[model samples]
Target: MSAPKPIRSIVIVGGGTAGWMAAAALSRLVRTGVSVTLVESDAIATIGVGEATIPPIRNFNGLLGIDENDFLSKTQGTIKLGIDFIDWTREGHRYTHPFGEFGFDIEGVKFHHYWRKLYAEGKASWIEDYNLCATAQKLGRYTTPVADPASVLSRLTYAYQFDASLYAAYLRAYAEARGVVRTEGKVVDVLLRSEDGHVDAIALEGDRRITGELFIDCTGFRGLLIKGALKTGFESWKHWLQCDRAWAVPSANPGREITPYTRSTARRAGWQWRIPLQHRVGNGYVYCSDDISDDEAAATLMANLDGEPLRDPMLIRFEAGRRKLAWNRNVVALGLASGFVEPLESTSIHMIQTGVSKLMALLPDRDFSPVERDEYNRQTQIQMEQVRDFVILHYHANERTDGDLWRRVREMDIPETLQRKIDLFRNRGRFFRYDDELFADSSWIAVLLGQNVMPAGWDSLADAVDPALVRQRLDRIREVFRRAAEAMPRHEDWLARNCPAPTASVTRKTA
Candidate 1:
C-alpha cells in the first residue's frame, strides 16, 4: 500500500467572512505540512449585510482566543439576548424568541408544562413572565451570565449584532498575523486537472497562476469553483421559502436606547429586520419579488427606518437553498457559495463559521479521501436542513390573513422534520430537540405559543401536584426573575462602562 500524500498548500478563493474565516481556522488549527493562502479581488465587495447572529458566535471567537471586549470595540458590535418577533401570529401580536431556558425546570417536569397547566386555569401571565431574557429586554437591561448555577444571573445567554464588514477585517488581521498569505486579484479562469476534473489552479491577471492541493470556495453566490467548475448542482428550496430578494441599508442611530435584541416585523409580502450596532442601525426589507418590486421594497425599507438613512438601500437577490455537495472533489464551498437562507434568523455568518469549523475537523490529506468528503457533505446537509426547518417555522406558523404570501405559506407543506416537531408540541406541549438541532426547546416553545399554537395537553405530571401549588410556585419564580432583571444595568450603561468602541481607530493594531 502506498502512503497518502500530505496536503501542503490550501488556496481559498474569494474573501469576506468565509474565506477569512477558513484562513483563521486553518492558521490556528492546521497541523504539519499545511499552509493557508487566500485570494480575493480588490474590486469585489462582500455581502456584509449579514449582521445579526446567534450565541455560538461567541464560542467561535473564544476558540480563536479573541478577547470579548476587543471584538466588540472593533466590530461596532452590540449585545443581543434574543429576537423580537412582531406581528408574526397576527396584527398587533409580538413575542420574543429568547436565548435562555424558561424559569429553570421545576423538579422533574419542564417549567413550561407547569406554566401551561396554570395558563389553562387562567392563573398564568404571558410566556415572557417566566424568562429572564424577555424581562431584561423589556426593561432595557443587560448582564453576562454568572458562573453559579444557583444564581439568577446564570440563566442569561447572548449573541451579537455587528458590522459584518469590520468583523471580516478583524479576522483578516488575525489570520494574516498567523502566516496565511493573501493574494490580491480576481480569478480569470479555473484550471482543472485532465485526469479527474479537479481544480488544479486558478489564473489571475498579469498572467499569474496559483495552484494548490486543496481549494476553498468563498466566492459569494457565484460558486466560482464548486458549482461553476465541478458542476455540483444546487438543491433549490424556493418552494418552501419563496422570499428571494432583500434591500439592506444602514441608518443613523436614533439617539435612543439600543434594545438588546434583533427585531423582525412582518410586512405585507415579507419581513423587515432591525439590527442595532454601536455606530449605526442596520435595516432591511426581505420580500418576495412575485409580490413586490425592487423599488417598492427599497421604499418600504426606507420608509420603515427609525432614523435617517446612512446610504441608499443595496438590493441583493438570492435563492434559498444549498449546494448539492458543499465539499466536492478537491474543492470545498463556504458561506454563500455553499448555500444561503435569507438573513431572517441571522444564520448567514453562523453558517460561514460552522462550515469553517467542519472543514477543520475533516482536514484531509492530499489524496482527498472520498469518505471524509462524503461525511462533511452529509453533516453540512443536516445542519442546513435543520436551520431551514426553523426558518420555515416562522413563515409556516403564521395567522396573518392580510397577504397572499402569508396565506400561501400557512398552507404550504413543510419538511417532515418540522412537521413532527410541530405536531409533538401541538399534541401535548412536548417540544424535544432532535439530532442536536440549533433551535432549542425554549425557542420552539416561544414561537409555538406566540403564534397561538397551544397544546391540547401538557405533561401528565403537571397534574401530579395540586393545581394551586403549581400556580404559587410559578408566581414565586416569575417574581424573582422580574426583580433580578430589574436590578441589572441597562445595556447602554453596561456598554459605556465595559466595552464601548473607541471614537477613532488607526489601523486597529492590538497592543
Candidate 2:
C-alpha cells in the first residue's frame, strides 16, 4: 500500500457568507504551506437576508480570534436572545422560543415536567417566566452571561442580528488578512480530469484557469461545480416545507429601543421576519408563490415595516431541501449550493458555519478517500434533516384559521422523527435529544409549548417531587429572573455604551 499524499491547494467558488466563511476558516491551512484561494465575481449578488443567527455563531467568531464588541460594531449588529413568534398557534396568540433553558431541573428531571404539574394545578405561570433570556428579552434588556455557575445570569445564551452583507465583508477582510487569496472572476466552466472525472480546474472569463487539489462549491443554488459539472442531485422537501419565495428589504430604524431578539410574525400565506440591527432593521416576507403572488408578498412586507423602506423589495426563490451528497468526489458544497431549508429559525448562516467546521474536521487527502467523504455526507444529511423537521414543526403545528397555507400545513403529515418527539412531549412532556442535534431539549420544549401543544399528562418522575417544594422553587426562579432582567441595561443603551456602529443614530425610548 502507498502512503496517501496530502492536499496542496483548495479552491473555493463564490463569495457570499458561505464562500467567505469557508475561506476565512480554511485560511489557517496557509500556515502548513497549503494554498487557499477563493473566486467570486464583483457582478454577482448574494442572497443576504440571513441576518439572524443562533448562539453557535459566538463559537465560530471566537475560533477566528474576533473580538465580540469589534465585530458587532463593524457589522451593525445587535444581540438576539431568541425569537418572538406571533400568532403562529392561532390568531391573537404569541410565544417566545428563548435561547436558554427554562428553570433548572428538579432532582435530575427536566424543569418542564415539574412546571407542567404546577400549571395543571393553576399554580404556575408561562414557561418563559422562568427563563433568563426570555425574561430579559421581554423587558428589552441586555447583558452578557456570567461565567459563574452559581449565578442565575450564567444560564443566559444569545446569538446576533446583523447586516448580512456587512458580515460577509468583515469576514472577507479577516480571510484576506490571514493570507487567503481572493480572485474576482466568474467561473465559466469546470474542467475535469479524464481519468477520474474529478475537478481539474475552473476557467474564468478571459481564459483564466485556477487549479487545486480540492474544490469547494459555494456558488449558491447554481452549484456550478458540485451539480453543474459533477451532476450531484438535490433532494427536494418542498412537499413538506411549501414556502418557496421571499421579498426582503431593509428599513430605517424606528428610533425605538432596539429589542434584543428577532420577531417572526405569522402572515396569511407565510411569515414575516423583523431583525433589528444597530443601523437599520432587516425585514422580509417568506411565502409560497402557489399560495400568494410575488406582488402580494411584496405589498404585505411593505405595509408592515416599522420604518420607511430603505430599498425596493428584492425577490428570492428557493425550495426546502439538501444536496443528495454534500461531498462528492473531490468537490464539497456549502451554503445554498449544499442546500436550503428556509430561514424561519435563522439557521441559514449557522448551516454555513457547520459546513465549514465539518469540512475542516473531515478534510481529505489528495487521494480523496471514500471513507472521509461518506462520513461527511452522512453527518451533513442528518443535520439537514433535523433542521428541516424543526422548521416544518413551526408550520405543521400552527392553528391559524385565516389562511389556507396554515390549515394545509397543519393537516399535512410530518416526518416520523419530528412526530416521535411531538408524541413523546404530548404524552408526558418527555423529550429527548438526538445524536448531535442542533436544538436542545429547551428549544424543543419552548416551541412545543409555545404553539399550545399541551401534554396529556405530567411526568411520573415529577410526581416524586412534592408539590409545595416545586411551587416554591418555581416562584423563586421567576423572581430572580425578573430582578436580573430589571437590573440589566436597555438593549439600545447597552449597544450605545459597548459597541455602537459608526452609522448608528440611536434614539432612546422608555421600555
Candidate 3:
C-alpha cells in the first residue's frame, strides 16, 4: 500500500510579503503539476512598517534562489548588523545587541563566565566592545563575513532594512515568473465543505467562485479563513506581552553618520524604533493604548524623530498572541492573520517565512492526517512561545522608572522559561539554548548584561584557565574587532555601489 497524494490546487489569499512569499516558495519547491494561485485586492493595503530584520532572513532569501545584490537593489535595502537599545536599562545608558557572538568560549564553558570574573574584579570593559558585529555596526561599516574561520570577521552576521512593499513587489514578480497565477480581488466569501467543515473554496465580489483543495490565509489581521471561517481559537498573551498598538511613519534621513544598526529608544510610555534604509529612515512607537492616547503616542513618535516627518504617522492596532493552531483542517494562516508577537525584534517577516516553510515541510495530502496537523501545530506553538518569551524579556527585565508603563512592565510576572534563563545567567553567567531557539546564547548575554543583570558567580571552568590568560584573551578579541570594523566599508557606500534600487523603466508595477 502507498500513501495518497496531496491536493494539487492551492489558493493563497492576500498578496503582501506573506502571500507572495508563500506563492514564490511553493511554486519554486513544490512538484510540477501543482497549481498555485494568489488573490489580493488593490484596495487592500498591507502594514509596510516591519523594515528591520534579523539574520535568518538570509536563509529565506537563499531558499528562493534570490540574488543578494539584486534583492537589495530592488528593495532599496541597507545593511543592518544588529540593534542598539538606548535608555532601556535606565537614563543615560545605551547598549548594542549584535547578531554574532561576543567572545570565544574555552573548554565548552561560555565566554561570559570569564568576562564576569574580570568585571567583578573591575578589570574588564563592556561585553559588546568585544563583538565584531557590534563594533562594525556602531562605526557605520558593512561587509560580508570573511571566509577564513581563523579570522574574527568570519563570525560577523547581518540582515537588512528595506521597504516591505517593495520586497513584496519583488517576490511577486519572482513568483509570477515562476508560474504562480495571481488573481486580483477581495475575498468576500469563504466556502466550506459541510461534511468536514473544512475550507473548500472562496468567492470573489463578482460571484466568481474559485475552488481549491487547500487554502492559505494571508488576509492580514482579519484571519478570513483560519479564524473567521474555521473558528480557530486565539491564545491571548496580553498578560505577558502588553503593548497592543503601534504608530509607524517614515522621515527624511537626518544625514547624520548612518550606523549599520537599528535603534530602539525607550520613551516614557513605549519604545520608539529608528530603522535606517537607503532611501529614508523608518520610525515608530509601540505602546499600550491604555497608558497613552493615540494622539499622545503619535506626538511622542513625531517629537523623537531624527529628521523631519515625511508623512502623518499611521496607527496599527494588534493583539499580542498566536492562533491556537496555525494549520487547521485544509486552511493554513500566514502573517498577521496567523498571529502577531509585535516587531520588538523585527520577527514579523521571519515568522511569516517560518510559517510557510513549516507548511512546506508537512506538505499534506488530500486526506489531511491528524498526526501531521498536530505536529505542525505543536511545533508552531513552541516556536511562537519561545519568541514570545524572548520579546517579553525586554520589557520585564528593565530597570526603567520613567512612568506607569515602565513601572508596570518592570514589576509584572514573566514566564517561567524566561525566568529560569534569567536566574541561570544571574547565578553563574551561564546560558543554554534549547530546541534550537531563534535567539542564540550571545544574544541573551548581550541583552542581559546590557540591562545591568550581572551574574553573581563565574562558571567553574573559568577557574581552570589562568586569570591572566583570560584577560589576555579578552584584550586580544577586542583589538581584533576594532581592527576588523576599521577595515569595513561605510554601509551607505556599500549599498549604493553594490545594489541600487530599480528605476521606473525597469521596475514592475503592482497589478
Q: Which ten residues in a row have the lowest lDDT in candidate 3?
A: 502-511
For candidate 2, lDDT tens digit of each residue in 349-384? 998999999999998999899998999999999999
Best by TM-score: 2
Q: Write the per-residue lDDT of candidate 1 for residues 156-261, one digit (tens) a residue.
A: 8899998888888999999999889999998989999999999999999989999999999999999989988899999999999999999999998887887789
All candidates' TM-scores? 0.97, 0.99, 0.97
Model 1: CA > 4 A from native:
1-4, 29-31, 504-511
Worst 10-residue lDDT window, candidate 2: 502-511
Can you give the lDDT of residue 30 in candidate 3? 44
Best by lDDT: 2
The lDDT of model 1 is: 0.88
Best-to-worst ranking by lDDT: 2, 1, 3
* CA lDDT of each prediction against the hidden true structure: 0.88, 0.93, 0.86
Clash tally, candidates in order? 0, 0, 1
lDDT tens per residue, model 3, 237-281: 998778899999999877665567899998888899998776678
